[model samples]
Target chain A: MSEAALLVESLAYEYPDGNLALHDVSLRIERGERVALLGPNGSGKTTLVKHLNGILAGNSGSVSVDGVRVDLQNKDSLRRIRSSVGVVFQDPDDQLFMPTVREDVAFGPFNMGARGEELDLVVKDALERVGMWELRDRPPHHLSFGQRRRVAVATVLSMSPKILVLDEPSSNLDPASRRELADILRGLDITLLMVTHDLPYALELCERSLVLAGGHVVADSRTREILRDTDLLSRHRLELPLGFRVD
Target chain B: MIRPNEDPLKHPISDHHHGHDFGERLVLHRHSIVHHLEPQVKILAMFLFIIVCVATPIHFWQAFVVYGLLVLGTILIAQLPLNVVARRSLIELPFVFFAIMMPIFGSGERVEVLGVSLSRLGIESGASILVKGTFGVLCAVCLSATTPAREILRGLERLRLPNLLVQIVSFMIRYVNVVSDEMARMKIARLSRGFEAQGVRSWRFLANVAGALFIRSYERGERVYLAMLSRGYSGKLPDTGHGSAGIRQWAQGLLLPVLALLVLAMTNIWMSR
Candidate 1:
């Protein structure tokens, strides 16, 4: 396997209210590997991912992206790390905050100190990558939910992050849109860490899966192996579709 | 949840075939000469006009006439309709009416107008106050109608307004429509469920709605901040690609402000003599 692109060592996090969200969690993702963080609701998956970009600091332990430590003191480094790991949040409404689509996509490049033709190029290239060039002038609020989600991804992609972190990439999507999203993810070679409750989606897109239960890495195995373990899935409140065959 | 017909998330229906342009239907015609002027110029011109109008004594009929003419000229030059200005200006008219009443209630000479006894100085000052306030309101309306909100914000930023205030205004303008739509949908949902509160007790229902909206907005804010950070948003907002005004553009923008100031200065000199 390629050297670990991300390393989290004994990561522990507690909410301000003294609720322990993550406890002694440790995982490492290899370069160019797509890792699905499978979990039930409130399983600390988000808290763990948030640490990747230094959005939330772990109460104990450390997160290192590409071997560089992520912390508050190295904020400039954190900014670079954040740009390197583009996060597409679950909610497109939250992601696409600008009045127009082009503006929203341009936001990232502009923040990265891209100006003049360089910024224009970044925006154009990113929009084209997601096949949203035609909808560049449209306001994001006016787009269909799927389109907005694609634009949301494009907004982060504009920054040219090495790792694309997505939260619930397929939630609330129509089947066609979900398939489209899956296809989009499959085509991209970037290291992907997707947090999802969609078991089938996780199986299809990721070769490896890590199941988190009670803030601990309970299962780490190949996608097929995890899917085949029916008893293990039910224990964590996760299940496969009835009568569904795994290829 | 995807209610295509009743989707609160649906974009406002666009009438593409009618040749209805976003700027053309509105008083704010994009790309017009007035529209392209620097924001500071527009702001300064408006300020000078308001100050001159307000400074003039209430009995100076000529001064009010000049101010009205200047406002009318501004509207014509902006190519905005009078009706639009009149309707929007009403936002502050009630407040101005209350202020103007001060003169009527002040202790001074009593007079009769159309056989109704009224304070003479009160009547005079009230008329003057009304004209001053009306001129100020007109000037402000013209600023908004001719200039797009984005440009106005840029102008505010250029004029050294508090950065926090400018950012707050920009965010408010961008999100106000979305928030309003959310409120409208909430109202519809409430109505469908047979919501009815007829008295002071209704305030609690309103408060609940407000609280719910606040929570939703706050959650939305958290998500937005995360999205920003994901895209490498530091503390500062990125520039919108509208750089500083060019020399020629700057000169062109200064033209109107200089003319307005000159006219005001001349009027002040004449009035003082």
Candidate 2:
């Protein structure tokens, strides 16, 4: 827990269409910090997290997970990064692609060569964490959107990741499910970096938050401070709910 | 199920349907005899049984009768609806049509029946095709009807089918409905904007929809790949380590094939004698 769990140094990325999705972005997240990435649409939040797990190699600069550099060119390094950092994408439909929820959760640990009771325990524990143990046998398609979202989180949790990188984890969930999910995340012990538009959620869960806009880290400070800054919030096209108070 | 909004009619796009469920197709009717058997054993047994029925000589029409009865017995044990058996066999309709024309097109020894003369060899071939086709289709339908698609994929994995093919099929079963649901939503979106499928102009609009769907699906494929990659996926999906079947389960699965093989062996010997 002493080491910086995730380190992004001077990262920059541009899409194939020549649009810069990330520009000189850099941040350090220590182990056990639940940091929220706050940004408007097209502000490169997704692009930034994709770089953390080596899914999208940056054009310049680097990302390191627990002291090991994330390089897609190196097979061993990429695998190490993937096992250490699990990216929970916005859409559960995309993440939970396996035929059954059990298999989907088993996928990560299974890939890491876990088997038999060990593998079973990993899947069971992960599902139990998200309150989805009963639905393990059910197909991901058969699950409702909220249920699918929870199962999607379990899919990564099964990997026993040191860091959970979620991209818009609360996008399509109902209000109750969203609250339940926030509670679930709060109870977990691992380091969490969640990208979300849910401002109140950010304040409720994360202590420190990073705001990215126009492919750069505009602000990195306390979640409450960022929310209270009406000037910064309005500049980024971010809005708090009507009559909602941070107090 | 908390209603996300007070007025259900005015919901956001986030309320989009996650699944279409593909309707009643893969539903498991519980407590059936065939459902109790392991999927891998059932798969191999059905394949071998179909082969045995197909390999029996056309000269011995009685063997076809016996094979049909065996399939019927298995269907009865499965508790599947009789109409389902018949309706699912519509897959063989084109083959049946071809078999129907066999007597008219081919030249062979002649035989008279009901004021019309047909070639004896052609009639024999047609009957053989019909019997073989029906038995094969019946066996496949039974296997699928008894086992869910997910179990079948697991069974395929156990059978040592190519890993890549198994994965392709597994994903297809999972996402076939999701893709179709996306298409349905796209149709609704267009319809809501005053678009209607009329005569000539509809094709271009439909083509554009297909193009857009292709792009969206391509993007989704990238995301799914990323998800897989994030979960430590290498070139191959690691071994499941859970497909081990017990001896009794194997025996139960193999019972059908062993019986069919016995029938075929007896018929082959009797025909030669």
* Native-to-model Cα distance after best TM-score fit, residue B155 in candidate 2, in Å: 1.3
**Model 2 C-alpha lDDT per residue in residues B218-273, reported as the tens digit of each score:** 89888899899889887686666665778988887778778878887888788889
TM-score of chain A of each: 0.97, 0.98
Per-residue C-alpha lDDT of model 1 across residues B103-164, encoded as one tens digit per residue: 55766777766776677777676676677777787887788778655567777778778877
What's the TM-score of every candidate structure?
0.84, 0.91
lDDT of 2 at B175: 78
Best by DockQ: 2
User: Can you write out model 1's per-residue Cα lDDT over A20-120, one digit (the tens) per residue?
Assistant: 99999999888899999999999988888788888999889998888778886787898888888888888888888775788899998888889888888
Per model, kept true contacts as a fraction are 0.72, 0.92
How much does candidate 2 score in TM-score? 0.91
- Candidate 2's displacement at residue B211, Å, is 2.3
**Considering summed lDDT, which 10 consecutive residues are worst modelled in model 2 chain B?**
B10-19
C-alpha local distance difference test of each model: 0.77, 0.85
